[model samples]
Target: MNRPLYALLIAAAMLSGCVTINIYFPAAAAEKAADRIIDEVWQLKKEQGAKPEGNQP
Candidate 1:
């Protein structure tokens, strides 16, 4: 019984080690997304600056 348990554990460990994870994303898409975010931030800043300030003492 002990031998079988040890064999099962070793087989599980080996199989788990064989797994591989792959992540893929397009560079052009990422660049376009970044540009859009930057443009939005810049536009917001410009709009904020353009607003007239309230009367101050």
Candidate 2:
């Protein structure tokens, strides 16, 4: 019983070490995303301004 438990613990430790965590931060991609967000907000503002106010049906 003790032997099997030791083997399982060792195996779990080895497997955990094999995992890799990758972090990416791309400046160009971030800039493009920000530009797209700004563009969408500007578009919404334009559409809102082009519409008539005070609920005319």
Candidate 3:
């Protein structure tokens, strides 16, 4: 009975290291997506040629 319990504990400990999780995302793709979202949310208009109302010189 002790041998079986010891074997089971060893098996569990060996299998624990085999589990893995990895996640990856491309930086360029994320930046492009963020730019598109910001443009949509702020309603950037380039074709209108209207001066932006701001304190910007």
Per-model TM-score, in order, reads: 0.34, 0.35, 0.37
Query: Considering lDDT, which of the candidate structures 2 and 3 is the better prediction for this target?
Result: 3
Give the runs in model 3 whose Cα sits over 4 Å from its true position. 1-22, 46-57
Q: By TM-score, how accurate is candidate 1?
A: 0.34
Clashing pairs in 1: none
Predict model 1's lDDT versus the native. 0.62
Candidate 3 local lDDT, 1-57, one digit each (tens): 599999999998777645431234556557667766877899974555343333344
Q: Write the per-residue lDDT of candidate 2 for residues 15-40, one digit (tens) a residue.
A: 77655322446665676567568869
Q: Clash number for model 3?
A: 0
Q: Superposing every Cα of model 3 onto the true structure, what RMSD results? A: 13.3
Q: Model 2: clashing residue pairs?
A: none
Better of 1 and 3 by lDDT: 3
Report, for every candidate in turn, its global Cα lDDT versus the true structure. 0.62, 0.63, 0.63
For candidate 2, the lDDT comes to 0.63
Top-down TM-score ranking: 3, 2, 1
Ranking by lDDT: 3, 2, 1
